[model samples]
Target: MSRAQIAPPAPSGPARSVPPPPSRPLPPPPVVGPSTRLVDLAAPEQPLSPHDPRSVGEYTLTGRLGSGGMGTVYLGHRAGTHGVVAIKVLAPHLLDDVDARTRFLREGQTLQKVTGDYTARVHGVGFDGSMPYIVMERLDGPSLHAFVAASGAVTDGEMLTRTAIALARALAALHADGITHRDLKPGNVLLTSAGPKVVDFGIARVVGQTHHTPAGNMVGTPGYMAPEQVTGNGALPATDVWAWACCVVFAARGDHLFDGDNILDIARRILDGPGAEAFGAVHRLSPRLVPVLRRATAQDASDRPRDGAALLRLLDRSGATSAVGHAGWDRLVGGGVR
Candidate 1:
């Protein structure tokens, strides 16, 4: 006999009939519950749109990190490795423009040789048929622009000093390679777990290259842009320093160094006002930062710190000490700057 048929029953009730258990143990009570999907903390990018391309070159794109004037940036992993990479593909229409093609190719070639902890290392460049794309290591953090918007100003003195130092180091690395990052606004400074990594070199030019764009055509964000750049004097090491100072002020005060009702108004403020005017809202700021900002954002580029290395030396002389000790540097870097 089967076990079910041979099983014995419990003692009968004294004065009542007992109910028999249902055949075949009842399926565990239906699991009716709300959905509780766990989120992926590792992935910081947005989901790919239905129309987004699934693959680029040898990488399979899984998400869209962001889009820019030049092209779309997709998050993906190389076919053979689990490591994530950011694939920036030039817009299809730009492929027909000779200048655009030249600049896109030059950006990758320039970054290939420029490698350091302060830079987002370029992995490779290739063409998906007619469209060209550059592959770089993906950064798992927000841009300085996004961070400031969400966290307001970085009021901690130690944080401000650390950020300024990291950016200066990155700039020094770039200048060492004879490259001037034409676009050094807060949006291009990626604050990662490793520290600040300067990015977006599309408009960057070699130190001695002649300006090809028309004199009247201006580039870069006006508020943070150096006066020389707004007036079409062409980008130089000093231009980055000016923007860097503007960024420092913004991070410290939660306001743009030069603000106005419109782009023209902002441009006018940057062009017409002195760096001191931008510090009106920054009260109780450490006296040490005053001269640094003044010289970095001088109306005349010649009056500012000559280069990134010079800026560092100036900071050292100004008593802007590092926020953390040698061990603390690693701890702060691992946790990321505010």
Candidate 2:
């Protein structure tokens, strides 16, 4: 069957709600013992070749930022403007895949719909032979994933509150532009000196794009994907919101809510398990934040907060607004928070 013709598997229970399993005594908090140190999470595992050629067009490569399943991201600078930026050069093997190229270009176009400080700004695109590349603003900060790993967990109520606000505002802009960021995770959020900036719009979908996945497949970080995304149905603004909640949960607890050996197993647990137990380990989290998290992580998209606005409202009601204001948000963005 063609890729577009594949159908997502049907969900087993009610779309809106899944009854929780019987309550058991809450588990004790996991021991917070020191482990091996990872001081420089932003440092690339391998240094960039100093002699690597610059982009064919206007930019010069300075250093490597990071590499992932798709490609290597580099720190680059535009010649005339001397503007620093990040560019993702698609993997050589992926250049042979028509679908992958199309998806990459789609991401560049869709990101234009989202405009805000919290979302990375896409500047332009270039090609080095058949390998397509995208140019984005250079955000000098560690990913939230790295921050959480180094700092243990974000137990400060004010920090979580501000982070939620920034993320919600960013998602609101994307939803307004009729785009859905299919992949939203800690690794994709950069904690800059100014504040949190969301990056990596690689797997997003515009409003009218056909949404389908190969059978028995899914395309998102396993622990953070919404139920619909996990089921391979498709993602919407609600899916982003669900992932946003998972991000907050990760920041608050320093552990993934859904634990499994692999993506498929994690998907099954999120679809079928009673997740209330997952929140129990987060003792440092304020009680007021629980309901907001619960709403954000609702099994059904319709049952979750309708949009970023609604999520922001819930956060406001939780009395986090005042704290965010006094927390030196500017200094945090300036790289002082770390």
Candidate 3:
């Protein structure tokens, strides 16, 4: 689930295992073992605490997925239907914060319209009594942040390429719909069985919306924030591209390229942009990807690729030039980028 206290969590943890919710309960899939590429498998959901509700709207709360500063996500089951879902409810304290409440609901509404191979599906959004809540299809896997931290960098070249492309498309789709996922980082990319699905729109905005955060306050994870974000100018689609490039590098190298002692230090480096060493790292692992990231991480947003489609085209060209040929690209993209 997208979040607070959630950090792209709410049923998110490489360590935690969850059984298929009543929803989409296929026969048990093969157990994920040490040899498996994924970090998680069919496992038990965390038990709910006493304070957790027994039910929300039409869904019965079954277990705890996770919690964040804004709210807790519960594994929910509805009567008369086999569908199981993750339910995110606004914290009681936020009820009086009109801005937070409005934004929370807006996230739900916008998310409902955004669905494809690239994103988690939104099922419902409503007020269960006084509480505002969002219901989403439960995803079974770890975030890219957890995956890279636990397993190491995405060393498989083809998988890495596909990951870079899928994630780029996810953001592209968001921007196409006027939704900007302001917080695009490894933590928000879920490494699911189907491939990577980008999640968490907590800080996202529809086009032309005012500043999501108060003036002078930071909004995204520091290492991944774009220069525009650091300068407090405004977040653009290029801003997401900046974060995406950093994440791609992280996937290749198993670490963040920017290092700093504190928030201010990190912010300073972000504004300074990547150095020669960063490009060198990509050059060692994926020479073709270097230029794509080089442009994406440009200090000036104008210098970056225009949009996701533009990025996709760049990726296609990069893939074409790489050892992986056109037919290979087709298989990697599950027939096509659709």
Candidate 4:
């Protein structure tokens, strides 16, 4: 509930391990109060309107970054310092919902231990009056979702390969700390100058940790969620793998693997429909990677890569490493491998 934007339902199954696609930065969504828009990561910050809160505790709010069901995210600067941070303010109604607030705080705790180039570092946590808020490194980049919207699916073979590996590394770090990024999607991944950094840990959970979400209710985007998450069985490190595979395909094809007008349809297709049928078309694009993706998206979690680190190994062994290196990586973050 404290997660980033809710996405269309993803299908459940074992997906073969594959690389995720390259995406550009994301722009903020329309929400109540002062708003700002971004054309891309390099675009200047949109000035805050009169209705926007000037500050949230020690952070001086500068512009609206984005919003979702849980809260509004704003770009801010630390008072008297040049440090920039993205501020997420909890929704007013959820303030009274103990479970929501608890999860919000837990997200901070989960991310606090994760340190690396692949995640948005948690800077501070506090409240703006009755609203709980989180401060994070303000990345000068856009969400993969926005990038795809503007540039179409990433076509550079090397960029896609690098993105997949980077995200896999990020997930490996998260799982090492017992954190499951329950919601791993293009929109939740930000493409920055350094590389792709996973954002919005609002729905992340520790391995085997209990949750406040009701039983039988799904907790993640249907299109990107693992089978267990969709069926309410549970979330594991492999769950993120499944989502990562889906994202990879999306980035390559600029389309959803499972198509439907509603969640039920998507769920049914994932559970009962010919699973391979969905990926049939794209399978032709990169035949060699099909088997890897199949293993990652397998309906049975055991069939997939054990974790991000393992997935990276598979990619390396399978020759996905051919186009990856310092030069390729630079081209990846800089807009394509030459």
Candidate 5:
């Protein structure tokens, strides 16, 4: 199929893709119930950091796992079930901003609605003072980004196939809930012993929510954004498919598909230039896969796969497998970042 034609931008260049109409406003935040806060009987005695003390209902904070623009994630344990959970504590400074808090809370609610082993599970949520925190299943694994960084480009066709399957399943679960994981980069995909688990839904939007992301405001990771996303058009399931294709390309070649001034520029190049040549150097990949990747990364969202399941089927048709027997999983959990 021919790629979607780009509309001209004002007087020159391709035309900009128009965003879908805003949906209804998201529902009010769910009320915190008594069960939401378990006893701190097994809570850790020491804080993960001096800045953010570890105390949220019954979960004890062990150490700081990671921090991002939104908040810090802590390794915590729940005494009730002896379960390890990752607690996401929003920055205190953001409490006053209703939009930020609503987005943060929406992440928790969105994950809770996604029921699948490929997706992270939300256990509970509470507050440490005005800072909101969410308790989630603590996954022992490195993000796909970290794995690629350590192992270099994944040349083994089998490993790439496994990763693709896990990710596709995760995306399928997300779409089933009427949710779109606007962000689908390597960093957001965690590789655990059980399997790959897709995490980080801070920028996700439910189908019917009206709080449309503003134009020119990008929400996903730069290198993985779809062409339409770069144009400031809102993302859909197809957008996730485009990013998924980028992930596959990264696995095969260990490089970005576009080299533009920024995400928007990259999107423009992918839409208008010979962007499919980015994967030319990867010899391990099947020649047939090249066309599939090109279509997945098509400038128009409509040109991509219908959903994650469809993507998974395409990857399966490639016939790839894992070279090492779960060694990647063990190394990821055991390796410490200094």
Candidate 6:
């Protein structure tokens, strides 16, 4: 498959309604190359190496933002404009891996289709020669994981509720269109001035589908993968719901109930299925929210909230919604709420 990127058309209507699932047997996305320009960036913690390309298409590389398991993201600027964007280039190791390339391309395509207030926006996706990349809006904020690491775990109840609610709504948006963010975790949840914007859909697919991956290869982080994910049975929006509970708990305790141990052991424990009873230790904060999480992380996917829409209703009944204004949100990013 020729490496490609797709820029979803600008949103023309409300983003909450359901849409048809993306056509399968993937097609190449249109090549979208923005213009070039220079943007001064303070040196990143990890600067671009001599080997890194100075630009991809018309966007000039400014600095290295960061990298993930599958790609290196660079800060770039479009020509003749003051716009800054995040360029996510495919990791060199996976350049020849067809599955990895497919997943990367699918991620860009998924972002184009799944859009809402909490969904991360994609500018375009394309290949700079053989290198596939996705250009996305530059969200200037720390990830939920980074913020919790810098500060301690979230101790405030309202703030925790706000975080939980924001993530639930984001997931609901994806589930509305039958998309599942198979890799829902703290690192993928960017805490921006606009609240939480869900990013990285590298492993996302339609609910109840798993054939996208090579058999026996699990598609999610060990700690957050649902039971079916471990067995490679199938994926459901509930699979994301299970991971959602894990992220919320990470914010509250800065740890996972089934945390630590090796990946194999963690997967085994998750398969063993620990429910709400295991979360008794952290009940002090968000006592009501804990029960909701208990159900969200249920061992059986059927026992979970079903989808984001249903999950939102569960949160509402639990009073998880809160008036966590700017001040409360600021605390998560160290007074950096924009």
Best-matching candidate per lDDT: 3
lDDT against the true structure, each candidate: 0.68, 0.67, 0.71, 0.69, 0.63, 0.70
lDDT (Cα) of model 3: 0.71
**Could you tell me the lDDT of residue 325 within candidate 4?**
56
| Tens-digit lDDT string for candidate 3 (48-149) | 666678898989998877665567778888888887898888867888888788778887887887855677788889888889999998876667776666
Q: List TM-scores for all candidates, in order.
A: 0.81, 0.81, 0.83, 0.83, 0.76, 0.80
Q: Model 4: what TM-score?
A: 0.83
Worst 10 residues of 5 by lDDT: 7-16
TM-score of 6: 0.80
- Put down candidate 5 lDDT per residue, 22-119, tens digits, no spaces: 23332342233322211111122223555556566777777666654567777778677666777888767788988888888888888788877777
* Model 3 TM-score relative to the real fold: 0.83
Candidate 2, after superposition: displacement of residue 12 in Å?
30
Estimate, for each residue in 1-338, the C-alpha lDDT of model 2 and write its tens digit: 23222212211100111222213433332332333222233433223554445563567787666655466677878767756787777767788988778777777776666766777778887687777888887665567776776666776666676787788888887777777777778877877655677776667777887755665456666777788877767777888989888788788888777768755677798897336566653435555667778888888899988777777887788765654556455545433333
Instruction: Report the C-alpha displacement of residue 53, candidate 2, in angstroms.
Output: 3.2
What are the per-residue Cα lDDT tens digits for candidate 1 across 1-338? 22211111111001012213323343332221222111111223556666678999899998766664467788888777978988988867788988878878888877786856777788999999998999988775566665666556775566666778889888888887888886776767776667778887777777665546666556666677788877777778888888888777777887677777766777798888565456543335455666787889888889988778888888888877542345533444444333
Residue 235 error for model 1, in Å?
1.8
Superposed Cα deviation of residue 154, candidate 6 (Å): 0.8
Looking at model 5, residue 272 earns an lDDT score of: 73
Q: Comparing candidate 4 with candidate 6, which one achieves the higher lDDT?
A: 6
**lDDT score, residue 264, model 1?**
70
**lDDT for each residue of candidate 4 in 1-338, tens digit (9 for 90 to 100):** 22333456431111111212213343554331212222233323455555567888888787775555666677888757976788878766799988789888887777787866688788878887887888887776566665666566766665666777778888888888888888888777777777788877777887656776666667788777677876877678898998888877887777776557877677776665236455554355454466668778888999899888888788777776664556755444444321
lDDT of 2: 0.67
> Between the candidate structures 2 and 3, which one is better when assessed by TM-score?
3
Evaluated against the true structure, the overall lDDT of model 4 is 0.69
Clashes of each: 0, 7, 9, 27, 9, 5
Model 5 global lDDT (CA atoms, 0 to 1):
0.63
The top-ranked prediction according to TM-score is: 3
Candidate 6: what lDDT?
A: 0.70
